[model samples]
Target: MTDLPLHELAIERHIAAPVSHVYKIWMERLPEWWAPKPWTTEVVEMDARPGGRSAMNMVSPDGEVSPVEGVFLEIAPEQRIVFTDAFRAGWIPHPPFMTGIFAFAPDGEGTAYRAAARHWDEATMQSHSEMGFEAGWGAVADQFKALCEETWVAR
Candidate 1:
């Protein structure tokens, strides 16, 4: 393994719900509010287990569809999830992007959800950061929280 840049990015948001509830929404109904605008998740398959397959089709504003497929590296139900964009369904190496880890922790009557991405190089990290990752992701998180709250209350 070569020496990568090792970029770490994290965002924490308080969702108006319990950890289990929030986690369920994330895993089951992620496409509801995953992307603030044009993007959306079409979960081709989600096994929620180590070595399980996961794929999502993301549509851009201009109607360009980018299919991101990967595998679950780790999964701690209602606590944490670790996934990588290493291989797609065809068992081919997909675009070399960073790994993602999403964690949910109990907060007073709510849940503290954290989304983090680990990049392999400084350039990659900087490029993503410069592309408004913080703002875009923040918006998505807000949307996610709202969706979760709504779903929980409706249940």
Candidate 2:
């Protein structure tokens, strides 16, 4: 096995909701919690199966749109999801950026949700850290909590 990057950015939150519920929202209600206030998410193409396509656009308050296109490397419903920006649908090569893992596990009666971003090198990792990984992810987590807490099991 090859060595991984020396830098990583991760954030975990104990969401006051079941893992199943959290996963449901993650898949279906992503646009609801995927972005913080003043920004919104729009899924252009998403298929959660392995090797499936996942693409989304983040619209900023100033009307700027940024798209993230990737392939689903792995998905275990209510457990975890891994996706990489290195490849698009059909396994086509794209500019490698980050491989992210979103994991959800049972935490008491709630869910222990973690988001991990792996970089290919130290430079990339440092770039992400300097790009407000903590604040951005923190805002996203809070938004997720609000969405799940409000919707509960209404899916």
Candidate 3:
């Protein structure tokens, strides 16, 4: 097998919520926690299946919209999701950026969550790191955990 993390950026967290619950919220309410505070996400489409399209707009506080379009490579419910910006829907090729891998596993009464972005090269990986990958992705993960825990309590 090839080394997957050679050009990867990742973040992990143990969320205080069940894997099922975390996955459910992640799938159904992505925009709620996708972007960090003051930045927002608007989902254009999210079809959670292999080859399905996943499009969204990340809106800045000043209303600048950064459109993101990708296709899902794999989706294992309550387990993992892998997607790539290399291809839009219908297998149409696009300029490649990175492939996103997110995994969810049961950890006692909580969930072990991991999110990774695999880049095509070291330059792109470095670029992503320079773009505040840690702070930004960490904030998103924290948001996700908080939402899951809060929602789990409200359930």
Q: Please give, for residues 1-155, the per-residue lDDT of candidate 2 as tens digits.
A: 86665467999999888998889888999998788788999999899999999999999999999999999999998999999999989999998989999999999999999999999888998899999999998899889877887788564
RMSD of each: 2.7, 1.7, 1.1
Query: Candidate 1: which pairs clash?
Result: none
Query: Looking at candidate 3, what is the lDDT of residue 104?
Result: 99
Question: Judged by lDDT, which candidate is best?
Answer: 3
| Weakest ten-residue segment in model 2 by summed lDDT | 1-10
Q: Write the per-residue lDDT of candidate 1 for residues 1-155, one digit (tens) a residue.
A: 97655697778899989999999889888787777676766677887888888887877877888776788889999999999887664456877778899999999999999999888788888888998889988888888989889988898
Best by TM-score: 3
What digit string (tens of lDDT, one per residue) describes model 3 on residues 16-51? Answer: 999999999999999999998889999999999999
Local distance difference test scores for all models:
0.84, 0.90, 0.95
Q: Rank the candidates by TM-score, best first.
A: 3, 2, 1
Q: Rank the candidates by lDDT, best first.
A: 3, 2, 1
Model 3 misplaced stretches (Cα beyond 4 Å): 3-5
